[model samples]
Target chain A: AQSVTQLDSQVPVFEEAPVELRCNYSSSVSVYLFWYVQYPNQGLQLLLKYLSGSTLVKGINGFEAEFNKSQTSFHLRKPSVHISDTAEYFCAVSKGNTGFQKLVFGTGTRLLVSP
Target chain B: DAGITQSPRHKVTETGTPVTLRCHQTENHRYMYWYRQDPGHGLRLIHYSYGVKDTDKGEVSDGYSVSRSKTEDFLLTLESATSSQTSVYFCAINTAQGREETQYFGPGTRLLVL
Candidate 1:
């Protein structure tokens, strides 16, 4: 079985400041990791994903996440943030053997970009 | 969008009433899933279908029942509306075999059970 834990429930950052939203997962099998973003009253949009190979993966809106096997973490980061970036973020994973498509998600992290 | 559309956009109902939400898709990707979004819980899968008449339970499937009679339509029914079930519902589609399962979601249906 696979489960995810989002360390922070909320993160507030000033505009143009760097921010990181931490995520950790537990799974005995190989897994694919992903990050998604949701704006107010809107559906979720895929930010990025890590399938294989690289530990560092870049995503839309200048967002990125690093897949650290040792920490069992895939923390999302952005070097600089904008007020428009305020939204809810989710981290999800799917087992590799079963299929890299069916996802199990973390609770959530609410990003508040303040100017 | 992945050609996904959820019906009624927003609904308000009282407890004990039966309500059904419809999800329509034009993508024909084969995998359709129903998920609920809450304040703290990002998104929890209620049910998913691999193909017509093929369905499976997901993490939070107890109060929800799903059916897919055709490729383009998937339905989610709430037998008895409850305040606990009040949340935004999202329908997603994934072409797992080809696109590697990055799902595209619908706008969502906001149901308020009072």
Candidate 2:
């Protein structure tokens, strides 16, 4: 069975400071990794995704995630986060060839940005 | 911005009563999905539809049923609402334009069963 693990349930960071949300997955076959953000009272919005390409992938809002094959990790990072960046982050995984049939998700990490 | 909408953004129902949630998409995507979000479980799939009238169960489809009679609308129903079924439900569409399938979510519907 495939599963995703997000170690931290919540991460607090000072505004304008760098932030990193860690995610790891376990799967027998190749998989696609994705990061999503959900603001309060809103649905999830796609951050970035790793299909088949370079290990480093950049996304919206100056965010980036590095897909480490050997470590089985896809960590989301941002050089400087704003107050508006405060949201719950989720890590999801899907089977490589499956066309959105199943998308296993993590428990989610709440990013609290303080001024 | 896939133009997905879930009806009855908030609802309160009693146990043993039947409840149905509707998901409508303007994008006309081929694949639609229903998922529930709980405190510790994140988002778990309940059911999905591949096309009109082609539906299948998901990981957490024990007490839920779904129907898709058109490309734009997918409905999820609970035969008998339970307290455990009180959660936020989301609708998603598989809007894959390439090898990678990307899902766009709708503003969730919050259901509370007492």
Candidate 3:
């Protein structure tokens, strides 16, 4: 079985300030990690994914995450955030060998950006 | 944006009534999935289909039944709707091109059981 944990339920930041949302996972086998963003009253959209590549993976909207295998962490980061960036972010993991993709997602972290 | 659409984007029904949600895809993807989203539990898989008439249960399949009669259509049904079953439902398709696999989602259907 695989599971994901997002420690922060909510993160508050001022406009133009940097932000980081923490995520950790537990899996018996190797895993693939992903970040998704959901705006109010909308479906989730993929931010980025860490398949089998360099630790650092860059995503749209100038967001990035680093995959730390030893630590079992894939934290999303942004140099600066805008009010429009306020949304719920989710971290998901899938077993690499499953053949079919079955995603297990974290509770979610609400990013609240203010002026 | 994988050409996925869920019917009855918003539905309201009473408890004990039966409800069926439809998920349609324009592409002939072999794999399709259904999920439910709540406040604390990000999203939980309800059911999935690998091919026409080939369906499997997911983590939260206790109160849900699914059927896939065609490659582009999947249906999820609640035999008896309950208040606890009220949540946002999403449909996804696995677009696996070679080794790159990603699930594209539908806009979602919000169900309210009173």
Error of 3 at B76 (Å): 0.5
State each candidate's clash count. Answer: 0, 0, 0
| Fnat by candidate, in order | 0.57, 0.64, 0.48
Q: Tens digit of lDDT per residue, candidate 3, span A1-115?
A: 9999999999999999999999999999999999999999998899999999699999999999999999999999999999999999999999852346899999999999999
Once superposed on the true structure, which residue ranges of model 2 sit more than 4 Å away at CA? none
Instruction: Encode model 1's per-residue lDDT on B1-114: one tens digit a residue.
Output: 477889989999999999999999987778888999888777889999989999999989988899999999999999998999999999988845354567778999999999
Q: Scoring model 3 with DockQ, what do you get?
A: 0.62
Model 1 gets an lDDT of: 0.90
Worst 10 residues of 3 chain A by lDDT: A94-103
**Candidate 1 chain B: 10-residue stretch with minimal lDDT:** B95-104
CAPRI quality of model 1: medium
Best by DockQ: 2
DockQ of each: 0.57, 0.70, 0.62
TM-score of chain B of each: 0.94, 0.97, 0.97
Give lDDT tens digits, candidate 3, residues B1-114. Answer: 789999989999999999999999998998899999999999999999999999999999998999998899999999999999999999998887687888878999999999
